[model samples]
Target chain A: MNPTYFLLLIYIIVCTLIITYWAAKHSGTTKQYYIASGTLTGYQNGMAISGDFISAASFLGVVGMIALRGYDGFLYSIGFLVSYNVVLFLVSEPVHRLGKFSLGDVVCSRFPGQKMRLIMAICTFIISLLYMIPQLVASGFLLRLLLDLNYSVSVLLIGTIMTIYVVVGGMIATSWVQIIKTVLLMSGTFLLTLIVLSNFNWDLTLFLNKVEEGTPLGEQFFLPGHLFNIPIEFLSLQLSLVLGTAGLPHILMRLFTVRNTYEVRKSLISATWIIGLFYFMTLILGFGTVALLGYEALIAKDPTGNLAAPLLAKVVGGDFLLAFVSAVAFTTIVAVVSGLAISATIAFSHDIFFHILKKGKTTEREQVRSARITAFIIGLLSTLFALRLESINVTSLVSMTFTVAASSVFPVLVLTIYWKRFTSVGAITAIVSGILASFIFVVLGPYVMNPSDGLFKTEAIFSLYNPGIVTIPIGFLGGILGSLLSKRIKQKETDFNSFYIKAQSGYSSRGES
Target chain B: MEEKLLNYIYRKRKRLFIILIFALLFYFFLPLSLIFIPEIMNKPSFLFNLPWAWVYAILQFPMTWLFCSIYHRKAKKDEQELDAIKGEDVN
Candidate 1:
């Protein structure tokens, strides 16, 4: 093992263990296990929120994409940054006021049925699991690259660390890990940006000109359609990214950690600013990679451009900076995987096991214990699956999570909050159909069924890579049609009135208790 | 009191919807417009040797933040107005 890699890994492990040890004491109760007992301030929650949203894919994969794909990669960053607005304007305040543990909590608040809860739990679990695989795969790739470990060993190591964090320290540990990682990621990117700028004597124009010089694509690098030429495909991807973020179980769960609607707004605004600035810095780093490392060299280093940022760091600031960037990337993956694990665990324990199966009669201790066990199981399962999926592009796998989220969860959550007529039947129908539609589309789509390497070994029937453009509307229609055709639940009106009042105002659901 | 709160929520929701729609439209305008007018997609501007697409891509970061800030302020103002109404009712 390289000494620098070994030392940096040791340092990161020590720091994370220390933070996890301190956070373990706060994980005794279910509330603390899930949402940190709703004690996080706006600024702290903002940092955690940004940390949760800006995954290793966004930091490493996106910068890599921009370095390779030019303008298209920046479009991906914008999709992510602007998607927070969907959460901010539509989901955040309602979700903060209504939910206790997960998105299932908010849905159950309006519907109050075991079937609805189970459906929501299943949707959350699937989305979280889909999202978790990419993070774990990214972790495996990073560890294999940085530490020279076998891919399976790296996958297992990441799974073990993530399980320990979630099972021992829960959301408190997860949030703190994310918070620290965000700080490290932002500062690291900022430093890299500074170095890159100084290399060009802080002249962005000179840097841009140099990036285009001697490149095969030349001026075409700065234009769109290089990666995604088709208009519909680009639109579909943009739709999924912007809308899917609000429905991501891990991101949605972050909203409940704040105190009120006001804090939700504050947290989102702060998160937006932090993430925006981070993306801006990523642009600098991406261009710098092309300028410093050259396009062909970057592609030679990593075909997916995932290594562009780290490679740029190594070239600019030598081995020490490279080690630092690699370690930060590792921790970033850990933080994200832990968050995904906790969300899946919460769906199982709070939504399915406690509420749906036990009819909400379980004790807090039982709930917390079940959550820990579920986290371990999920961690193991995702690790094993990730080992098999080592060859797939991490960013592409991550985008599939967004497609499922945008289709299944986004429509249901939006309708539940805004549409008073939405019933449990409607919610169930929307989630089930939405998930099935998107899943079927992805499996049939070009990503999975390309003639060369796809499982089916034929041309894809579903031409679009992302299923959002087709499935999102289907999800909304399913909810509407289901609600229209189902028998009216008499209590829905009164329930809607109460939920509306609480959601629109800053009224705490806990206050009534 | 309930009627007043309902009215307040109704008006605020409408305003919120309008603002959110505008933000979404503004954010999507670039990509959608590019589809319609592909000629301008490669139009060169004064920002170094970067084309219009690059400038638009870079501007999205600040524009996203700007819309969020606007929505934040508007939402806060709505909340404060409702609180003042509640205070009057208590008085």
Candidate 2:
């Protein structure tokens, strides 16, 4: 490893240790472990939330997409930014007001049963694992590129660091790390954007022309169909991105870290501003990469263009800048993977162990202990899986998680909040059908069944790469059809009314009978 | 009085939902519409150097932020009004 790479690694390690050591005292109780005792201010929580939102996929993969595909990659950023509207307008308040620790808490609060908790816990685990795999894979790839480490060693290093972060400091440590990561990421991108613009004398049109000159497609680089050829595939990708964000278990869990609904609203707005600006800067970084290093150079460095940002750093500022960008990228993966591990751990310990198996009677100490152990297990499992699936494109795998989330979790959460008639049957059916439909579609889709490299070695039967367009409707149908067909449960209506009042009014439901 | 409060809440919810639906449709309209009018994608819209497709994609960032700001203000005002109505009932 280069000396600067060593220094960057040491800096990250020192920061990680300080954060964990500081947060360790606060994480002794279950509440602190799960939601940081609901003490974070709006800005802190917002930064943390945005930090979680802008993961390795957005920092590296999306910029890579923009570098390679131009306009199409920026379209992905727009989809991601707009999805915050779904959270702000519909999901955040209710999730904050009603949930205690996890998305399972919000869903099960209305249903009031172990079955719903169990189902939610399982879904959260699956989604969190799927989300973590891409982050781990990306980190491994990044380390291999930057430090010349073996891919397996890189994966192990990331997995171990993330597990340590969660197991020692839980949500407090995770949130602090995320806040720090977001700041570093935003500043890094902003500075890079400035440098790129300054290179072209701050003329966007001139920059565009230079970028066009650098590519074979020229003016066609600004068009949409280069990356997503089919119209439905593009539509499906957008739909997944917009809806899947609200469904993400880890993101939803962030809402529970705030004090109340009002803070949740404030946090969402703050997160939106930060994330939106960061994505806008990504456009400059992406196109700037094309202008500075050219698409051919970027593709030569990394075929997937994952190295566009860091490689651009090298072109503009040499090895020192390259080391800093690489470190920030590594921090991005660590922050996201830590967040994912904690969410999955919460699902296992809080939702399943305490609520389902132990009947919510376990001591807080035991709950925290269980969460730590679960985090370790999940970290190990995801690291092993990441090692095995080292060759898949990171962004595509990340998009699949979004598609699954949009299909399964988004529909049920929306129905539970808005529809008074939504019953346990509908929620359960939506979760099950959403998972099954998206799974089946993805298995039959091009990602899995393309003739040359696909698992089955046959022509893809499913034309669309993303299942969101089809699966979202199927999920809603499962919920609606199940609710309509089932007998009207009087208790469920009453439960809905109470939850609705609290969710809408931002009132505490604790003292209510 | 409680029934009236529920109605008020319901009406506000409906208005918010309408805004949300409209905003979402408008945001999605450009790209989805481009599918039917593929020829438009090639034409330069704003800056002569950039094509309509690029303009649409880039414009979405500002448009999304605009919608978010508008919705946030509206939602906050509605919440305050709801709180006022509840306080009136309690008094």
Candidate 3:
């Protein structure tokens, strides 16, 4: 056993457990448990948001993707960064004003019914689980490679720690874990970038030449078409990534962690800066992997390229640097899964249990108790799912999650806030159709149904791996059609005038016609 | 006065929508350019002897930072303006 890696992993676990211990004292109230009672400053929440957003997929998978696939892999990072703009411009402020603890609160602000809450809760549960499975799957691979543990055991270990973090400490602990993880991840990646540049004597031209020389594609490495053959697939993946962030339930839940709209702006701007800078450093690190380690070495070590960053660290700074980077990746997975688990817990306990089942009559003590129970259940379920997904590349599952989010949650939120004609029927139709369409597309698509390495030994019915181009439009259409159809019945028109005013300016006055 | 406030809100929405459209167009240009005009994107430029495609992709980082900064400044100012309008109505 490697003592250095073991010590570093132990250090991170101890530190997070201490944070959980401290947070448990403060998280007595439901508000504190769900969103830390909205006490964090703008920049702090921004760091936590970045921490929540960047997972093992971005840290380990994307770097390896770029090293192997070249230019096309970098496109994935770009799609992720650009999506924040959609969040900032369209949904951030309204989400802050409307949602208290969950996406259910945000949508139910307009619809105001148990049916609406149930729909949003189901969407939140599915999205969080979809996102969490990837983080668990990535950590399973990481531990199996590092400590030679069985994949299922590794997944279960992480799942148990994550459940403990959320169940005991709740959002406060999750936020601190993510914030600390952001610090560790940024510094680790920055230090690795500096080491890579120093190795090349800080020369750009020579570095570029080496990058081309190291890859098999040679000069063509700088161009596209390596990762995707069809142009539509490239466009489809980009569309999903660009629109997906605004729809992510965990990311949306982060909006309620701040005080006001001004802080909301600060949060998005700071998140943009940190996320933007992180992607740029990852670009250099990706290029460094090719320049320093060569393409064949990276592929030989891990064909999926998940080990590119850590292996690059080993070649440059020896076993110590490798251990440090691996520990950072481990913490990355832990922090992200904790964020996902808490969001799912809040969805179940707050939206489903308190609003729908209990009719919002439960005591705070009982609410928090239900939240802890939900966290445990979600953790166990995700671990079981992740164990079966060990053979899959971590990056492939990520696009499916984004596609589902972009298709379902995004259209519903946008229409609810921006489109006054949108009705409850429309919201329900949009969500149900969006989820079904994306799920069916993924199941029938090449990712699941391919002949060689897929779950099924048949040709894919839907050719495109990411079918965002079709399903996103279908989501919007379902909402529009449902609203128009329900309009002819002359149903009780909801108070769109006041809801729109409050959503925009955070205040609703009676005098405004 | 209420009409005035509604007008202001309407104007703000229009302006924000315009900016959204502009930003989306700029962001989507990269993938579209790669697909429709590979010859232009692959051509090496003078700065750093990198291809235009690489330059375009790298520029998106600065573009995101710039847009976010601009939106932050404008939205903060708009919040102040909104409060001023409300304060005037109270008076």
User: Highest lDDT among the candidates is held by which one?
Assistant: 3
Residue by residue across A200-287, what tens digits does model 3's lDDT show? 8999988999999999999888877788768899999899999999999999999999989888888888999899889999989999
Residue B41 error, candidate 2, Å: 3.6
Compared with the true structure, what per-residue lDDT tens digits does model 1 show for residues B1-91? 6677778889988988987898799778878976887678678877885677777777777887888888888888987897787776669
Q: What is the interface RMSD of each candidate, in Å?
A: 1.2, 1.7, 1.1
Q: Taking the tens digit of each residue's C-alpha lDDT, what string does model 2 give over A1-513?
A: 999988988898798879898999889999999999999988899999988989887898888899888877788888888899888888888787778888888887788888888999999999999889988988897899977899999999999899889989999999999999999999989888888899999887799889898887887888767787788888888899899999999999999888876678778888988998999888889888888899888888799888899999999989998898988988888999998999999999998999989997988888889988998899889989999999875655776789879988999999998998788899989999998998899889888898888777899999888889999999999999888878565544345666777667654345331
> Which residue pairs show collisions in model 1?
none
lDDT of each: 0.85, 0.85, 0.89
Q: TM-score for each prediction?
A: 0.97, 0.96, 0.97
Instruction: Give the better candidate number (1 or 2) by DockQ.
Output: 1
Please name the candidate that would achieve the greatest DockQ relative to the true structure. Answer: 1
* Candidate 2, position A26, lDDT: 86
Off by over 4 Å in 2: A392-396, A488-493, A508-513
Best prediction by TM-score: 3
Cα lDDT, model 3, residue B67: 84
